[model samples]
Target: GYNSHSVLSILMQTYMDSSTVLAPVPSFWGLVNSAWNLCAIGKRQSPIDIETTHMIFDPHLTPLRLNTGGRKMYGTMYNTGKHVSLRPDKTHLVNISGGPLGYSYRLEEVRLHFGSEDALGSEHLLNGQGFPGEVRCKT
Candidate 1:
């Protein structure tokens, strides 16, 4: 299977060689909102440190369920320069529900990101450490 991020990065590198150089790609440290002076602001920004001691267990919460209905999903990979985004086929959507969600939500797009090395590329850090990679799914 192809790693979308890797493919996108290669595409971006090729583009960079031909076009006028662009600013740094939007990343976990500097997102599009602040970089472009956009009005949208993230209230709950990521890459925060989540300590296990601060977590609370809720016994009543149901486990999250992902129902694809046995249908095959097709999508295209995009090289946004900042990230490798996935645009799914509008016809077949994945249904995700449960846990604290009140209704099932359909997946929109999925973005994948990774570090230059295997040890440091996660948007969310647990106790101040990065993971090998991360998948940012939009729903």
Candidate 2:
């Protein structure tokens, strides 16, 4: 029997190895591992294309508030072979409120994605255009 941690460890180890030839593609991620089933079949996934013309602006929307306690943040960055990730230290409390959010949310992790070329890096596309890099913040 395999646990979630073990499965993650195996996935991480396999992904970290550049020489591995059996790496699964995006469409096959869920088929190869039960833990990643959502990757293959999930209806609501991330990194979707954003069409600016479809965006609606609401004047009632308030400005988002970021509370950092006026202190510098410290975090450890890691290169996971696929992307760069930053996990903030627990001692650094960063929170965000207002805007469209109903409650205050704490900062969790940040991910950066880039490619060797200028037109091939971003995870999300804007008007069918890709950028050199993209930064994603997860909370």
Candidate 2, residues 11-124, lDDT tens digits: the string is: 110121242233344556678666668768978655666566766565777887768789888889999987899988889877655674445666666778777876566777
Q: Which ten residues in a row have the lowest lDDT in candidate 2?
A: 7-16
User: What local lDDT does model 1 show for residue 138?
Assistant: 58
Model 2 stretches astray by more than 4 angstroms = 1-42
Model 1, 70-95: lDDT tens digits are 98878889978766888778777776
Measured by lDDT, the strongest candidate is 2
lDDT of 2 at 19: 27
Top model by TM-score, which number? 2
Residue 14's lDDT within candidate 2 is 11
